[model samples]
Target: MGSGVLCIAESAGNELKKSAFELAGVGQRLAGALGGPISGALVGEGISGLVEGLGKRGLPKVYVVDDAALGRYTSDGYAIALKAVVQAADPAVILLASSAMGKDLGPALAARLGCGIISDAIALEVVDGKVHATRPVFAGKAQLEVEPADLPVVVSVRPNVFEPAASGDGAAETVAVDADLTGEQIRVVVKELLEPEERTIDLTEADIIVSGGRGLKGPEHFHLIEELAAVLGGVVGASRAVVDAGWRPHTEQVGQTGKTVSPKLYVACGISGAIQHLAGMSSSKCIVAVNKDPEAPVFKVADYGIVGDVFEVLPELIKAVKEKKGL
Candidate 1:
């Protein structure tokens, strides 16, 4: 049953999310490793031409579930549509981003297909024609290796850890599948998505993130964090303490209870790297910890460390980056 791998394309604002490319890269590589073809599945309105971009990212086939029912995300609609396509494609491996949407639907789809599902994977490999996944367990304290015994192994992955992939010479070939709605009534109808107080880059997809904590002192000083983020073309993030204290918006909080981040550079300002906080960003490529306390757990994982007050250090760091880039 080793057919191929399919990554569900996700939208970032109006276009394809970077994580889509990352998964396409994974799918393409896995297909090559298994001597199979790489394919993708697209579900949404007005995304016909979107498959062209997917083809350029190494997808040979783009299965489109084009219908009015797919205009908005309804759990049942998505599960039904995806189930139809996957059953038609007969794929042995399916990949999805470990984001809110993927997390919401992966398990439901897995249950529908009667297959094993793995989520929030940090690493994946196809060995001897079998998919093996590694993911954090016990809140980032340890990791577990999961080898599904089912033919169609469903995987949801952390974004940004996989290397960014460039365009390829592949062409998009469309495949049509009949829609089904077996669980449509059982799914909750989402009325609306909450309007973010300040819509910034999603923590999961940010290239650079500057996060603050209780050490930022108060809500008024978050402006400093925002200013630094502006200087660096990064997003300002915060710990749960800061968000719970109303010092910053909950949208900016990065922790187990909030959004998970895997940026190229995750600069922790005044954060002590609580396990809950580490669970969100421990997968980042490069970590920099800036805090007054020298022995903070954040420093242990930091590639670069600055043992100083964030208030005193942040301005200097911003000035240096600006000067270094001649901003």
Candidate 2:
């Protein structure tokens, strides 16, 4: 069994995603525990420039596959390219960020390699030279510690749960691997990539998240939530009820069926803490809940609770935050 750790680095428009460094950090720790070196896998079109950044994150060797066919992400294309890297590195452990792409690609790559896969891991440890992952279960009501009964295992870690590796000045040797992707292999092709006109911090990656629930009354009043998030230099999040009502996009929803977040601070406004909603943000470092109902479920887990109308409380809270920032 190969003892090395291979980090699957993610990138966007020539820039490496923060989760890439996070994976590198975990990869370094895992490699040290296994008494092996850490390497990286970079896959995409024109992403060779990112190899140095991976090296700064402590990876000594990086395998890259730069091909025009990989200009846009496809489940099959990335899986095939990454499989080539896996064969070249012969790593025992593979680490990936549990982003949209990772969630889709991890399983496919595991299937091709015939290895066990663990997704959305919040904590990871090396016990007895095997990776042990701790994950939330039963809608965050319970925790489970699991390990794949195999050497070559693929683990997708939740975003923001782990700290990124400290940058260094080291150089990494680049290994260019051929991407053997045939048109027949990719049954589905992405014709175009549509990006949001105004990009906001991704909810999963945000350090602070201000979320709203049904108590906001209507969609038009979401400006309060937005203003507060802006003041806090955070991102806006929504409850499933808000998304279901078309008050917000599904991307902003935070719950069991939506995105799981573990921000440094999470503020819930007008949200009655449904179990599913709590399941997502309960892991946050600090939770502040504002609801008219004093006994709202959200308050049970909140570090601070405000029993008042969201409409009245939000404005004052925003004002206080602005004053604190001297804005």
Of the candidates shown, which would achieve the greatest TM-score relative to the real structure?
2
Pairs that collide in candidate 1 are none
Residue lDDT tens for model 2, 1-327:
877899999998789999999999888888999888799999999999999999888999999999988899999999999999999999999999989899999999999899999988999999987789998889999899999898799999998889899999988999999978788988768998888877888888899999999999999999999999999999999999999999999989999999989999999999999999999899999999999999899999999999999999999999999999999
* Backbone clash count for every predicted candidate, in the order shown: 0, 0
- How high is the CA lDDT of each candidate model? 0.86, 0.93
**Regions of model 1 farther than 4 Å from truth:** 181-186
Return the lDDT, model 2, position 86.
94
The clash number for model 1 is 0
lDDT of 1 at 308: 99
Give me the runs in candidate 2 sitting further than 4 Å from their true place. none
Query: Which prediction has the highest lDDT against the true structure?
Result: 2
For 1-327, candidate 1 gives per-residue lDDT tens digits of 758888888875558988999999787777777677778998877777788889898888888887776777877888888998898788888899998899988998898888889998898888887788899998788999988887788899888878755887878898877675444453666677777766777878999999999989998888878888888899989999999998888888898999888898889999999999998888888999999999999998899999999889999999998998899
- TM-score, per-candidate, Cα-based: 0.96, 0.97
